[model samples]
Target chain A: MTLLHSRRQKEIRKRLEGMRPRLYRVAFAWTHNRSLAEDLTQDTLVKALQAARQLRELESLDAWLFRIMSNCRRDHFRNQVSTENVDNYDLVDERTPETRSSEQQLIQKVRDSVEALPETHRQTLTLVDIEGFSYMETASILEIPVGTVMSRLSRARARLRKLLATQHVDVRGNDSNARLRRIK
Target chain B: MTEMEHITEEMLNAFIDQELADNDMMHVYLAMSKDPDLRDRVCELRANKELLRAAYRQVPAPRKYQRPPGLLPRTAMAAGIMSLGVGALLGWYAHSFSQSDNPPRTVARAYQTFDSKVKVVFHVSRNDAAAFAQILDEAEALVAAEDDKRSNNSVRIVANGDGLFLLSAKASPFKDRIRILSEKYNNLVFAGCSQTQKRLQRERGLSVDLLPQVSTVNSGVFEVLRLQEAGWKYIPI
Candidate 1:
């Protein structure tokens, strides 16, 4: 390979490394496990780098990277046990809390509510609301219709609204259907 | 009031998400001004987006991850190389400088190959929707071909392995089509492999929920074998 080609590949690798944190956040939100999310991020990066030469348009790099992460997560679920054992996790807090602020508590509450969503809705919600992907981009990543993406996003937000309202439903996951706080 | 009542939750969602065009945006904006409940709903939806964005903004740092430093193996590259070798092998296998083995026949002179063998068992072992759709098409044609003759033609689609996905309620895209076809045809059957379902439940912990129209066989492979033994044509997709 030419020196110029080699330099381009190196630049691509650097950008992919930068995507690690974002990928980890989404993976963690979906899996609610630290090691699993980290492993998924690593797997996505490895796959992306192995086939780095196939990246034709530089602008689509973010979408392309995310699409890989989505596939990796799907493969993990397919290989893992059923969805019944999903949110029944141990809330292992890895970080020392500086302050028990109400903001932090609210954030935790929001995370819990998101965890209660169906897998498809959760994915759509995070990709659009959290990751800031366009509706069309999200539809392409999920391999569903744009209409499906909108509907899933709508459902996810509605559920979050109800859960956060604290008026309509006592639907917050109990101690048993617990979660994992942060994966370090 | 009429416009406010006409505005749907989806429209409100679209307005908050900034997915609507300018005209629709203006409509929502005016409606929100006139309706306190609509305004509160919009605020709540927007709050959900903000909370979600904030909650995930700071994630835990990934554990020290480092791969042993080299160019990783690319499956696509390997596949490309393998395809070239397979093409060369195929060319050598079918290579013929002279051609005089079988006599060419016209369409008019073509004869029936499977005479009175109207029963067909489609054997599938992959998670392919297109292949499943094709199987249904071919089965329909065969079943319809002898309707005038009132022959005892039948088709059984035996799914196993990953092919059980074709019959899954949550995953399959053709649930409605499968339901309609099952309702329309009396001699058609959609059989799921029981062993595969059990394996999926046991290994993956998935409670496999198939469509109501599908029935379970002991094993799809064995079912195909049995059907073939009983003079049914074995077709794999």
Candidate 2:
């Protein structure tokens, strides 16, 4: 590599290292798989390096990197693959057994339930729930109107609650009929 | 207004994230006073939002620049062009090549649709039996609710390793509930991990029932990838 090129590469690596955890988290939220998230992060950095010139005068590097991560996630989904794998991403440790197993179960149950959501709803949830992006920011990233982001997030949360409630019934030892009778 | 009619998930998130306008905040506050369910829902969503953010606190960033695979020898081009009085030509070539060498436009376009969907996976290891049961119950409930709300809802539940426990009739904690959920929501699918089941049976003498609703896949990681490809959002449990 030329001396100039080598210098540029070092600068890029420094920037990437600074943003590694955030990028991984965004990709993880997008793909929900550790390995896929890693691959996506790597891909995003490669593309970012190939295109850093376009990012001139950007206010937030975090948002820009997130934008790139978001795009990589979309591309993965567009390819028509199933995301039903057990996330073995060695990054986060499994929940310890000694902790509130039932509550942890509830959390996992909610996570799995959210996993089943439609694509748009899922994206909305991740932006609003996971990344804590504002409605306007989510709208900009999603290329949707702010109103749509609001409506979608509302619906997604409502659906998530209902899902959690239903799953709670099963874990509590009541069948559907029994649970309905109790509710009625 | 009814108590259920107050601040919604969107409104509350906007408020918490400080995205809502003053007028919108007034409306949400008014609704919050009247609608207990809405209030509770907002709280739940807010908590979930916080949890998600905390979980993803350290996401990484992309690299700044990368060198291309190959380039023409600059010395040779410079020598040939100088004799031809083509200093301008050589300079233009070098500039254009450098720009083309790392096309930022393509990268920008590539990520134009950065966050189009949500992706999630359920991780149930062999030891976490209780968690497995709860996840299945949640899956059934989610499916049932979706059945009520939409005419054409699509939800897939892939069970791997101990997750297979939820699908088996003999050991399932919520077998009957799952059946009911499956009956009403045709979109609800239960997938089993072929490798996990094989290992269980051969290594531990545990029998795994790969039921009709529970289709076996190559691997859990591949299943997650497959679902993402099909445009299903993912949340890891």
Best by DockQ: 1
Clashing pairs in 1: none
Worst 10 residues of 2 chain A by lDDT: A175-184
Model 2: iRMSD? 11.0
User: Taking the tens digit of each residue's C-alpha lDDT, what string does model 1 give over A75-115?
Assistant: 65764553334333445674456664545666677777888
Give the Cα lDDT of each candidate. 0.68, 0.56
**Per model, how much of the real contact set is kept?**
0.42, 0.30
- Alpha-carbon deviation at B170 in model 2, angstroms: 62
Candidate 2 local lDDT, B38-148, one digit each (tens): 776566656655544543554332221122346344553344223222222222222343335453222112222433322223434343454455455544444444323
Please provide, for model 1 over B30-128, each residue's C-alpha lDDT reduced to its tens digit, 9 standing for 90 to 100. Answer: 988888887877876775676688788886554433223473535533442343233222222221101224432311111133355366677777787
Please report the TM-score between candidate 2 and the true structure: 0.47
C-alpha RMSD in Å of predicted model 2 compared with the true structure: 24.2
